[model samples]
Target: MQLGGDETRRLADFLAASGSGSVPSDTGGYIVMPTKGSPADVIRALQDLTATDRMDALAMLLREASEKPAILGDLVSRLAADERFIEKAAAAMNLAVYRQVLFRLETMIDDPTVKEGQFQALLEEQPWLFGSEYSCILDRRRWTRDEITDFVPRRTTDGRVELIEIKTPLHGKSLFNWDASHKVWAPGVELSRVVAQAENYLEKLDRNRDGILANDREDVTKMRARIIIGRDRDDDQRDALRRHNGHLHRIEIITFDGLLAIAKRVLRYFEDAPAEQCVVLGT
Candidate 1:
């Protein structure tokens, strides 16, 4: 096989001054090379192009892209051959999309007006913002006769529906109270009310679970729930929330801040992922 490439102006100048045909000890602005190069070498060959060569490369590449669009279908076929391949590809795509999401999330974290309704709307549009624990948002939002949950995202494990009840993050109000006497944390009235509200929603879902399954094919097994309210303002508050949540059995609580942190972790996972695992298509 033969390798082909275009050179960058800087690299071309270096090569000219160096008077070397072979790129010393590394990759080059592609002027083409012998075949049997590593995968990275091949990719660099395609990417490292002079301004003059870029237009021609772009046209040829566009033609190649347009000519064999079935290459993506070929990738899907390859994924079907290996489940691990599919998972890696999916993860790569999700991480690529998360950059846009993180921007909005970071912006909202400090914005006062991005409240419950705003958060709900964002989550509705981008449910993956909730992380991979939840499979997908259920089509059936009305869990019971009078109960309408913010979201009924199904758990990834068994497809059982998990209720997500999000209230406005603590702004001027308090969600936790510091108990000076006992040296412990206590739930503020708002937090207590939000927890109870989530419990009620769970209870209603449990009572109406069979009916819901029959009607909508949605599973609400045992009715576990997540209450997303308040903010972990500082290390103490964050630790306090963690301790408070540890005692609970069925319902789990996370502040908006915690939720954002989860997304950042996900972003970092992709950043650190192996290059081989990151590629879903192309040689």
Candidate 2:
């Protein structure tokens, strides 16, 4: 891979460090070279580099470990013995991956081909982005086949189920619009449709709550739903969403931008976490 300026400096530093202990010029036809060094020095060197470089090095190491299963197993066994290290490492990876997800979403938000399926898949894979209160997404049931709606249900940490509906901002309709007749912003046709569909899902699920409780072993009592869709064109529309959403009981609407803001806050918590050694690469 082509090295950037920062990476070039890192390479230079590495070369200078290993430049010592050269082979003799007249020591037979060939000589063995030293390929190992101090693990502490390696850790220090990695720490001196940027986080990106450290992650790249980690990716390489993981790939190498995958090829050598014994070492990988032993390494995991040792690392898993420390609960604190696991917590710190998990936090770091979560922050890194969330940043990446935010970047991907921001870059692809306007792409025409990327639709509900893409966003649904992304949110499902990273349910923590919704918040730590959520534990895991529930499996889609066959009952929703009749409605053909994309309702993502997640179990809360306390075992209550939450229905989440996601839509691409490419919905081609404003979520909140000025009601020229009423002289205030109100939910547009499309947004109202999604909310109604979510309520419908909730109603159906409520009716089948007992079935879900017995069969799926999930609690659906006093369930709440969140609708993720649309975009705010300006401050007025955003404020309007807040006003309208406040009127709803258990259902809420959140634009993608709002979701992004929420994700940023989650990231900030990690950014504020106590510094720890890089568990993956030994920073």
Candidate 3:
């Protein structure tokens, strides 16, 4: 069946809304065209629609295709045939997945008893949250035969090699405690301890830099360290982090909430553009 003007418009609205992480009111109302014969036939038709670059039609197609596993498989196969369509579809899918992850992270960050391993898992799964320009090269990666750091990392694009240490959000009080007597914020005990740990990791890497590069095939001479822990207590805490981070030339510290914010920003980058259409149209 050919998509009518109203259907096309609705699909556009849906695509726009989904890109922004909002569910359109009429998502469930869109109709999926029935397959003519085999799943391949349906995909061929969808490929035709994607040529138009109408993101709405593609959104509708994906929604409908999701209900038919066989057809979905066909759709996946066809993704390779069109670079533009595949890129758009991939971005849309990534944004959706990361948004769900962000929601779960919000809950996890609030739980004071959450373990450092859990946070490490999240970062490993979604490396973009760490930084737009960072990717996970190693997790619980061994520096020596017996010495493992929480993460051995790489630049997402191109930059200095880095080391990362994560601590449980529950391990710290506020990242910074209000020192009312001096009317200034000071790094909390947990934050200080983690920072020290990161520093130690950096030193270890430096001492074994040549060995690590030979083993991992990654340069570590300019490696820096980052410690992720706790949550910001207030604006004062954030200001404290800025001041504290400024002095530390080699190691940077960030709170759990700060990490979450970075993740959300990454999601926004993908959602800013309307995805290209991928709906299959009639014969």
Candidate 4:
């Protein structure tokens, strides 16, 4: 589960050299390449890979290695634990591949003969459900003025001055225009319906205010509402969430497909992020 500094450096070097812009040549047990960059550069380079690119590269790498059965286990194990390699490997490995890997790793962990650290290592390599840094103000029946300021935020980080609202229909419906009278979208789910949820969250944050978004200088006062109608749901959801669109408000009313796509991204982040940063709110 843990790599020594030297090994980490070497692994980082391997990842950076194997990246898209560099050439990688297998040199016996360890890969060899010529580059003036440090190991940190390689780690950063690996992180720079787009999720799509990493997934593609990992598939090709695994497929090619599958032809050589002798080194398959070592290759796969190294790829799984290497920080520089994991994101790409997770992306590259298909759902079936991931399932198989998790099953085998779980079996290893369940064995009483294995050490606790070994079990932890297996967990580090595999994870369950994935999701984004979800943030919401839960509405409760009881509250006080003093208790309001002491409320814990739902997001991963603080000082978030924007709320992004997304509106999408259940199916692939089009939003040609907004029905001003009903305050809903035409032929699809209305922007107001989705914004209503955001508004509720805002209201929970500031119960006594007349409007959800108050013109405050300190706390978050502005929100940029987005309506993703007829948009490609799956992978597009993650992209839509990440690209905040130059505005502050960044919430999404995504279809199940879109939610699934971003769910993976959130999972990937959960797997790779630091322990302290991974604190669960309700837990």
Q: Pick the candidate with the highest TM-score.
A: 3
- Residue-level lDDT tens digits of model 2 in 1-283: 8999988986676566557643344556431112235757545644654555345544654566678867776545544454243345444665566679878877656676787888987776666567656656666644333544454555555566667778888446687777899898888888888888878877777788788778877665577778888888689978989898888878988888887778777667657756452232221
Tell me the lDDT of model 1 at 170. Answer: 71
Ranking by TM-score: 3, 2, 1, 4
Q: Distance (Å) between predicted and true CA of 22, model 2?
A: 31
lDDT of 1 by residue, 1-283 (tens): 5334544655565677468653465655322323336668656644643333233434444455456876645554553355344345444555555678788977886787887888888888877678767767778777688988888887889777777887877787666788999988888998898788877777777788789889977666566779888788878777878887898767999888888888777567656877444332111
Model 3 quality (TM-score): 0.64
* Lowest lDDT 10-residue stretch of candidate 1: 274-283
For all candidates in order, the CA lDDT equals: 0.69, 0.66, 0.69, 0.44
Tens-place lDDT per residue, model 3, 11-50, is: 8976886798655556465433324456576567557555
Candidate order by decreasing lDDT: 3, 1, 2, 4
Runs in model 3 lying further than 4 Å from the true structure: 1-91, 157-159, 180-183, 213-219, 274-283
Question: In model 2, where is the ten-residue run with the lowest total lDDT?
Answer: 27-36
Candidate 2 wrongly placed segments (more than 4 Å): 1-59, 62-94, 140-157, 217-221, 275-283
Answer with 1 or 4, whichever has the higher TM-score. Answer: 1
Alpha-carbon error at 266 in model 4, in Å? Answer: 3.5
lDDT of 3 at 141: 73
C-alpha positional error of residue 109 in candidate 4 after TM-score superposition, expressed in Å: 32
